[model samples]
Target: MNNFRFLVDPVFSKRFGIAPFIGPKRFRPPALNINDLPDDLDTILISHNHMDHLDYPSVKQLNKRYGERLTWFCGRGTRQWFLDNHVKNVIELDWWEEYHFSKKEVNIAFCPAQHWSRRTAFDTNKSLWGGFAVWDTTHKFYFAGDTGYTHNISIFRQIGKKYGPFNLSAIPIGVYEPRYMMETQHVSPDEAVQIHIDVQSKKSIGIHWGTWALANEYFMEPPEKLSQAVKNNQLHPSSFIVVKHGEIVDLP
Candidate 1:
């Protein structure tokens, strides 16, 4: 099986730019400028239509550079946005649907997440929003795009029982604030730990923190709180890691 590595979110460089908000350090997202990515990248899986995850400029930049070399897999709601922006090679799927990249031995399936979607006021939930489960011959990876604590976690665990025991999971652990307001959509660090345990993943990496000031918590609170939660739960530190921007950690 081929190895897996995440080139974390790449952001454009500029003051008050969108890059610094998603990752911990203040650096450009990553230099995947279309032409720089591996020729066999084969697929680009997007979690949702959020600015951080579905970056228009970055996607456009990649489209310009790669032409038809890459295929974009996004939510049903995001298809029109991409089409409006002139992005080709796009395949949109609904939750629970599966797409297979036969040549790569990769099977990507859309899964439910408790979240809303909107690019503009008129487009709320216009597109389906959710996370993804990427399974191949050697490994299973779960990318929880953006979500709140919901029964979806239990559903995902059932999915794991049938198709998982994920080798690695990339889950969000930020943007939660003012519990009452954020609780319905964004999960706190403690919730994230529950997700990690529920999914029964061998290793879990945190994301969606230190990026945008989407909530009331201080900039560094997600990781700090996440660490404390892990310790309190007596979970191994290596089981729940917080990666820095532009940093890559290999799955076990």
Candidate 2:
């Protein structure tokens, strides 16, 4: 899932002045705005510093409302930003590191992803980038942050061998266009399906598309492409789902 409302100015308005690409206008408003978030929010999981994944205003608002009560978990080299922003109780983990929350009886492990990071030119790859595997007693979930079809896709096999056969997976299936340039950063729909199989997920959901016109494809193209790929591979339709903006799926 992508959330970028609080970053309207920096991401959409190009508050820093446009150099190359600016103003990634969204197709529709977010289903839940920052104010609409639940007060019961206890922990925040940040994948990286990208504006779409980690919004400054949103984090500030959450910290303002929750304070030390909120525990933040993020990738390596990203903790300083939270500290600089006055948010305490931050835990940053390198790939394959795990953290357990006794109170919640859940464990979260940072996993591998073929992706890079950058908020500004000088900060490229200054921080780590990866996905996460979260598990409770009976359920294991994978959140594939943002990835590409790297030759080292064997990383998924490692994930599957360790924490996978995932009960559910949220995989990015969009923002891939002009393959020459994007192939190294984003996964096309076909590649996403491979990730689903690679991770051994019982069910997978397609995300990262239809929210913003981040690539050359139309807003509705990802799901259609995914459907075709699934059919071509003879995979069941229900194996991977494309949910609507405000929809919720009841997991077993």
Tens digit of per-residue lDDT, candidate 1, span 6-115: 23334443222345354334323442345557655566777777665677667777777776766788888787787888887888999899988776768888888888
User: For model 1, what is the alpha-carbon lDDT of residue 249?
Assistant: 81
Clashing pairs in 1: 10-29, 10-30, 11-29, 21-211, 21-212, 22-211, 77-127
Which sections of candidate 1 miss by over 4 Å?
1-36, 151-153
lDDT of 2 by residue, 64-123 (tens): 877887688889999998899899889899999999876577788989788888877789
Q: Cα miss at 225, model 1 (Å)? A: 0.9
Candidate 1 residue-wise lDDT at 4: 37
| Top candidate, metric lDDT | 2
Which residue runs of candidate 2 sit more than 4 Å off their true CA positions? Answer: 1-22
